[model samples]
Target: MSRLERTMNRYRSLRCSGIADELQELVAHAEANAVSYLDFAEQLAEREQQVRERKRLAGNRKRAQLPPGKQLEDFDYRHQTTITKRQVHALLDFGFIDNRQNLVFIGPPGVGKTHLAVGIADKALDAGYKVLFRNALELVEELELAEMKGELKKKIAQLTRFDLLVIDELGYLPMSRQARYTLFQLVHAFYEYRSLILTTNKDFTDWGEFFHHDNVAVPIIDRVIHHSSIYMLGGESYRLREKTTAG
Candidate 1:
């Protein structure tokens, strides 16, 4: 490469800042004196600005990933036959929304509980909180797998870093004694410090049936509700609508 071009290539790679305008002056002087270097400095400054702009966009994108979807706005609270507007507002006002208390939504199958929980979680994420959504059965299985690999504790630590955790379908699967204990450990560690959004089709009275031990179920309920919001739901199955329409 020519001297001027070679110098410019090296300068661009260095990405030096605050040298562009100075390079213009130098280029002008160099042109008059038949010497080169100023143009190379200007090219480096331009490259630096380009790199910084790209980094800024990448950072914004990473932050945007925290909020998964816009389903919150379409939750259709008006269509939910069980929860009243007042109750919904109260939940938003509860310590759960402001102070990050855990929230448990208990109801029979087909209630709009998961929709409401996801709605609230979306709002939290929009407020710049980190969130993770998983089914209780899936998370329990994953935790068990991690335990077999001797990494359960590390996995729990990673889970705690999220500001909001949404665990749906808590009673879908019968948890073994070990699964119950591992889940208890996860919930206990997150107690009071982070927000947990749980949607369960089983009532608290039946929790022992899933856990398979009264001792574990009782204390888990006690700790979970100690500083939590309970939304007891009652309604027909939302799935019924589709069935009726199809008929």
Candidate 2:
């Protein structure tokens, strides 16, 4: 075998497949440019690091289950007058997550609550933080099932592993007593330990009615709102307006 082929085999054996894959092209470029030995080595290291970073982010995005195309830049600041571009841009730094603070977006349906929440979550994923997105009812149901299976603690532990948990469309439907209790336990476990981003259609006053139990709702609200940034989005439903205009 040629010397180049032998060197590539050595790289692969050392688990530097990223460098190995680009070795031929890299060697050619280095020789063509008369690049120093140190510079050539640095280039190889950079290629391997970039490849690993891309793979890591791809895996995290898959595990996050973020809705596609919900980036912050795609959000329409014009339609949702309540929140400005500036306010949302400030969150890009992600001090809230670092401080273990929550972000709660409250508004009527289709007013872009989910968009903003998911947008922030997408940014968090790009910043290398582990994130998980779930519809409120779906998350509660999973917890309820886990409770029945006596795996509630294990399930909550799994969820808490994520740096940020995004719960979308909360209070769209009333929860059952068992479901409410299960959800409360999960939220309580996250208290002061991890961060949460919640998009809800119900107000704080209506939470008691939505949960069907004031006793359960109170503590959950207490934990969620403490050390949280609350944004109230108010406007007509974007979906309805678009349908009307289309017609």
Which structure among the candidates has the greatest TM-score? 2
lDDT of 1 by residue, 1-247 (tens): 6765565556656664334324455566667876546655555456567667666555544543433443555655655756676666566543574585888889877777777877776665545466778878888998998888999899999988777788888987888888988898888888887878889988888888888854888878887888787888886677786588789
lDDT of 1 at 149: 95
- Predicted model with the maximum lDDT: 2
RMSD of each: 7.7, 1.6
Compared to the true structure, candidate 1 yields what TM-score? 0.71
Question: Residues 17-70, candidate 2, lDDT per residue (tens digit)?
Answer: 889999999999999999999999999999999988999899999999988877
Residue 49 miss distance in model 1 (angstroms): 15
With candidate 1 superimposed using the best TM-score fit, by how many Å does residue 71's alpha carbon deviate from the native? 2.0
lDDT, residue 175, model 2: 88
Model 1: lowest-lDDT 10 consecutive positions: 16-25
Q: What is the lDDT of residue 181 in candidate 1?
A: 82
Query: What stretches of model 2 exceed 4 Å from their correct place?
Result: none
Instruction: List the global CA lDDT of all models.
Output: 0.73, 0.93
What is the lDDT, from 0 to 100, of the residue 110 in candidate 2? 86
